[model samples]
Target chain A: MERPEAPEGAVWAEHVAPDGYTHRVLARGTVFRLANPEGGACAHVLLHHVDQPWERLNVADTVKVQWNAYGGHLLLSDQGRVLASVESESGYDALCGTTPKGRDMFVRAAAKHGLGKRDLPPSLSFFQGARVRPDGSLHFTGPAGDVVTLRAELPLVVLIANTAHPLDPDGACTRLEVTAWRDQPTGPDDPLWTATPEGRRAFENTHEYLSARGSA
Target chain B: MTVVAANAGWSALIGAGQTLTIVDLEGNQAVDFLVYSAADTAERYSAQDTITAQGNIFLTTGSVLMSNERNPLMTVVEDTCGRHDTIGGACSKESNTLRYGHHTRPQHACVENFLAEGAKWGLGKRDLVSNVNWYMNVPVEQDGTLGIVDGISSPGLKVVLRAEVDVIVLVSNCPQVNNPCNGFNPTPVRLEVA
Candidate 1:
């Protein structure tokens, strides 16, 4: 089901790069940040609109796409629209190979960013284990939980499928929640998020109109 | 707007609110860099973590840089020119020999510069990982391949990273003459850490 055929007039919403593969966008305005392994510029698709309409979709805005052998609707966004989607691909074991696994660092940073321990979805399964390092490459936990080791060099994105314990009933796969920058809290304690440049401009105009109304 | 130059061998520390600007006074210079936790030098920049967090193969402005332990290292505050390289890992001795002719194995590269400087502050080889090529450009081919192309960066072009915390910065004005990344003319660079 690679390149699941989209219906007519369907906007190219987002680009998905499967495990062991790299997906590049020919359009601009499509911004992509690495999911787990997290440090690189916001990779923009070569199109004029980087953010697709799919990014704004919520639970009801489900557009069926081929998921791990099946399609399911999961709670996608929040009131603030920070989180755009909650994806779970079954039957395929994949990993955010670049991200760290520990909760301590994640907790600390999340707290600083207003994402407390409670913020993480309670339904999310957690894992705490060290990966086996093979001769020169990294060792991975396969979809069947078998230790598959390889000797690869640095700067590599590695994903092992068919883990014994899939995050869901289907095989393991990377679940990414598409997000927006402006909707996210600036800091843990900060109640208000920073608005984008356009948002800020609109806010100012609205505030001015309200002020004038109050005076009149 | 700010300029700092690096002599043959030098290091600098960049603090918060201030940005470190690297300039290639002469064209074709590759700047090798390493970042560490200012509060604790034990933990260093982790390439895997960074790549995962950012969700891309390259680094440039607007990227919220992450550390190995999954901490925010810095953010690309501003960039006059766009498109930096994150997939093209820093150059090393073995790579120098392999990429170039075997006889060019002895060339000093960004990797060595990072290790040597980090050692001065109690860092080591394990600390080195993926880095951002500020002005370097590598375009993917039609077949989904990568090639080091002539840089799209020009003189006066700069990339800025705002420190999320007090960060220790190390950079080596690249001396690689083998590829077009450095314009076949590795030159000195300016370092401004204010």
Candidate 2:
């Protein structure tokens, strides 16, 4: 398959083959983008503080805290810090993908970083979503092209798997293109700095930790 | 009815359609719960699927506990604690030290309970998932901040769950001493199945 062109200013980019996974450490303020070219692909993403493995992505906290599952929302760490935020999104699917395939992909990625199966936590999916009907039953939306960018708020260990969403009626997935580029550090002047009181506190936590380490 | 001592753990195989009731013998105690297929431990409780299917974070009566495969492991047939938490994950030495200080590292926590009991069933750390905190109060503040405040449950308060399948139930009578989730002090609970 022909690889797509790298996005402008990308520090690095790669097209992960279908059913494959990738892991990398991205710096704070890096703009990490995941693009599903075929539109049917779903991606399972896991993140942790690049330096602190104990502080990892907490999907339940992300959904429970925001009360929404949109693609471009605050991705929170278990320790109450904003690891990343959806800077922009084209397709909405923040479903938690628990399929063995999705988890195994991350398991492989985690192992490369010296993390074991037990270290892997629940992950959030992209490019597929579901809605609750009036009857309390779920109605899954069809696959859609996912072009989402997440702004890292903390230096992060980004792990991603391009795998089929377990609930996808079609059960089809393809390659995913990931690109990382440098961006200006977030400051009080940025709208996202204090978007919401909850986000503000998360940012404060992130910033405080960074400053304590002399990274901020 | 089986009495679970404070800071201890228990596991059992509840038959399909059987009801298991957990009573907070002492008010304000947090009971961490998990359910897995008796025939296949791989199909363990999934907080994501359960919360996604129900469109609600707090579980109460009439809630169906969904598995990773999207099947019902159990249902909240009866609940008197009003609401239960599914997001505040089981505590561990790592989390204890992260939330509290490193000095609290030696304290026993829910993950240790799950690991000890789950190991008896051939389950390992990978088998555990986010668990239900019954009688524990975790309120999502208006600003979306989660607070582990004192419990809303009182003495004798219980929640009943009916196994939708022959299921293995694992529980940790939460021993957390660092938070208000257990009132900073753990206590005993009662369990009965019929």
Candidate 3:
């Protein structure tokens, strides 16, 4: 993985190669962005509260609370805490889940880096489009360039792995560029801060936890 | 190769042809487990697939863990605990609140143990799935209802698994105190790889 040139005034940037992975702890109010420079690429993203590790992102809860599996909004933690809210996304499919091949490849890649299965968390598949049928099978629609920006609600330890979704046909690995910067407060009335009822609860829980711990 | 403390979590890479023996060091303890194909993180242990393939809800000697992809990841080669629950699943804060009470929310649970331990290897919550509860005695009533009862396993009981492929196994020394699965008190377990 080569370090990418950060945009003007950005905190950090990196270019993740195919099968490459990166883990970083970003402070709350950080704006992180992932851009698929090439058309066909997907990244698996996992988020955890930096301090309260147990209070981590729960994909099931996120899906259930919003009744949507598409990734373009607030990602909720198990405690109903908002970990990160999507600022923008392009070229990603929200409907398709992980494919056996994609999962296997990620596991192998993690193993090579001395990480085991436990490290292989479920990720929000970004940039691969698909539609699910009535029978629970997924059909790939097409491919496009996907770029997503997220605002961290709590200090988070995020893991991003450059992997393909099962819907993707095997091809040359695509390059992924990531950038992060400090974000200014957009206030409580911002839609990003008030996306869903569950998100509001999560934010409250996080705030309460922080306040109780004297970290607020 | 590891001794998972009571209410803690342990994870390891068990290569193909390797065997992992889990011992009930203090007896009547439940060890929650999840496995994935080392080659692909997506190919993870699936309780539904395994139960459907074996026609049994309880895992024992000779039970082959089937992955979501319907591939074998590991095979149970030895068992002194008699049976393990594939349906009880791991204890989580949500489940704790639902079954026990909201007061139990702050109590530690298996999902917490898994996330805390798994983070060391980059795992997050999305990786969690229906997990195997070793030493737990969740019996299916004739009407298809399930009951969490006292474990059939005593001290010194053990179960062993042989990895059919290079695999990663995650274990949560269950911290569930609101249920009889851990005898209402969680304890340590021993992991030996051979």
Candidate 4:
């Protein structure tokens, strides 16, 4: 995996080879972006608030609460708070699987932090996406140079493992690059929070939780 | 046969083609249930696959629980309660504290039960996933908001499942005292193998 140059003045950047993983404690308002330069490289990502690991990513509630799984949607915690919002995406995927799976890799990454299997929850995958039919049929859409950007709505620990996603068909993932930059966090005044009734409620839950602690 | 005490846990290596009957001996008790392939625990119940396959979230009689690999692990053979919840996952102290407040942090939760009971089989936290909440009622509105409310089941109501393969079954009789899912009162249930 060739290393890509980090963007100028970027907070952080890293090249994740196939079978490699990374974890970072990012502050609220971090603009995190992941790219599949060569394609077929799926990132099985997990997230938890830096201060509160219990409020981790819940893919079930994320899909159920949003009623749709796609880019620009809010990914929620089981407690109904918006952990991060998929701000933009090209190769969109909602599933993870196959060899060196995100699940096992996640366990290892979590264990590094003294967090075990119990700390992990269902997560989202990027790079290889699926477009489903009404009858429950679906196919993959893995495009090269695909990218996704996520805006953290809270201080969080973002973990990424370059693992195979079932839709990729490669049975193994490839090299990927990630970079995080500073940005303004999503707040109640932000339209991202008021986009939908569901989004609004989730943001409200997030807002109340944050406000109670005097966090702006 | 096992009479799981109130707020206790139970498990079994259910053989393929055999059925395990879960009787809600006391009404409104939410049972948090999880299952894994006895041959390869990596293949465990995937709520995503199950809901995707069924085109619905609520599980009931005839619902085939699917694994993360998209294979059927079990089938609901009988469901007198009619609808079971795959959306309202097992509760935990972390979540209990998040929702109810810090005072409830010491209270036992379904996650603890799974960890303690699952340890007997060499399983740990990594093995737990979004679990089935038997007899728990979580209504989803058109806006996708979920409300964990009182159950529709009554005392002695039963839900039975036949193993589609050799599988390890783990259960936590939900001890949540913060929500109405268990009517804020925990109780015991009965499990019978046939």
lDDT of 1 by residue, B1-194 (tens): 33334324455566766677666665545566667778786455554455445554456677776765568877887776666655455665544443443466677777677777877877664345455566777553322234577887777666677888888877766666777888887666666665
Q: After superposition, how far is residue B160 of candidate 4 from its true place, in Å?
A: 1.0
Candidate 3 TM-score, C-alpha based: 0.55
Candidates' C-alpha lDDT: 0.41, 0.78, 0.71, 0.76
Ranking, DockQ, top scorer first: 2, 4, 3, 1
DockQ for model 4 equals: 0.15
Ranking by lDDT: 2, 4, 3, 1
**Candidate 3's residue-wise lDDT over B163-191, tens digit each?**
99999889999998976788888888999
Give, for candidate 2 chain B, the lowest lDDT window spanning 10 residues: B138-147
How far in Å is the alpha carbon of A108 misplaced in model 4? 12
Identify the CAPRI category of the predicted complex in candidate 2. Answer: incorrect
Native contacts retained per candidate?
0.06, 0.07, 0.03, 0.09
Q: lDDT per residue, candidate 1, A1-216, as tens digits?
A: 234233343223232332222222222111222232121111111001012221111111111011111112121111112221122232111112222322333334334433333222111111211121211112333332111111110111111111112112233344221221112212223222222322222223323433565721
Candidate 2, residue B31: how far the Cα is off, in Å = 5.1
lDDT of 4 by residue, B98-167 (tens): 4555567689888889989899989876677788999987665432345677889899999999999999
lDDT of 3 at A179: 93
- Looking at model 4, give its docking quality level: incorrect
Q: List the lowest-lDDT window of 10 residues for candidate 1 chain A.
A: A40-49
Ranking by TM-score: 2, 4, 3, 1
- Per model, how many backbone clashes are there? 48, 0, 12, 5
Candidate topping TM-score: 2
Q: Compute the lDDT of residue B139 as modeled in candidate 2.
A: 61
After aligning candidate 4 to the native by TM-score, how far in Å is the CA of B14 from where it should be?
1.3
Worst 10 residues of 3 chain A by lDDT: A88-97
Candidate 2 whole-model C-alpha lDDT, 0 to 1: 0.78
